[model samples]
Target: MSIPTGRQILRLYRDLLRYGRQLQFTDKNYFARRIREEFKQAKNTEKVEDINFYFQRGLALLKNKRVV
Candidate 1:
């Protein structure tokens, strides 16, 4: 997929955090903290490849973590 726009990235971040809270077996706080730390680490990403990579990674994470 094309690199995600800023708004899309923000939405993904929010979704990840929201999904983390719904985890039944995992620790939600740790999941949330990791998601926050990951986004913070990626905050300065400027390269298109890096942005795309993170965007795709986030999508995969959300897909895997989301509760049905």
Candidate 2:
């Protein structure tokens, strides 16, 4: 499979942010910050496998009701 487009990636990011809001965390701010940091770390990803891996990982976390 091909890597997701930028818009698709942003949609996932937004979904993750929304998921963060939906979860009951003691430190919501910390959760949000962590999401931002993870995204930032992958900001320069160009490899298809790497990008899809992260995208699927995020989706799995979302589906399994966990955070990345």
Candidate 3:
């Protein structure tokens, strides 16, 4: 797979944050924190293929939830 550019990664990160913000949960803070943590954990990932896999998975989940 082609490696994603910085701009693409930034865009996806923003989109995911936007989606997280729109989530309707009882504990919005917890949801937000989890989103933040997950992203933070993935921030240092070294493999482009792994990042792409995660990006695609996240996109699929967001699309399924009608958030994208």
Per-candidate local distance difference test: 0.85, 0.85, 0.74
Tell me how far the alpha carbon of residue 67 in candidate 2 is from the true structure, in angstroms, after superposition.
2.7
Off by over 4 Å in 1: 66-68
Backbone clashes for every candidate come to 0, 0, 0
Q: Tens-digit lDDT track for model 3 on 1-68?
A: 78777788777777777777777753657766776787788889989888888778767767896432
TM-score of every model versus the real structure: 0.87, 0.88, 0.73
lDDT per residue for candidate 1 within 1-68, as digits (tens), equals 57788899899999888888888998899888988998999999888899899888888877776433
lDDT of 2 by residue, 1-68 (tens): 98788898899899888888877764777878988998999988888899899899988988999654
Worst 10 residues of 2 by lDDT: 22-31
Deviation from native of the Cα of residue 27 in model 1, angstroms: 0.8
Candidate 2 regions with alpha-carbon error over 4 angstroms? none
- Candidate 3 CA-lDDT value: 0.74
What is the clash count of model 3? 0
- Evaluate residue 53 in candidate 1 and report its C-alpha lDDT on the 0 to 100 scale: 91
TM-score, cand. 1: 0.87
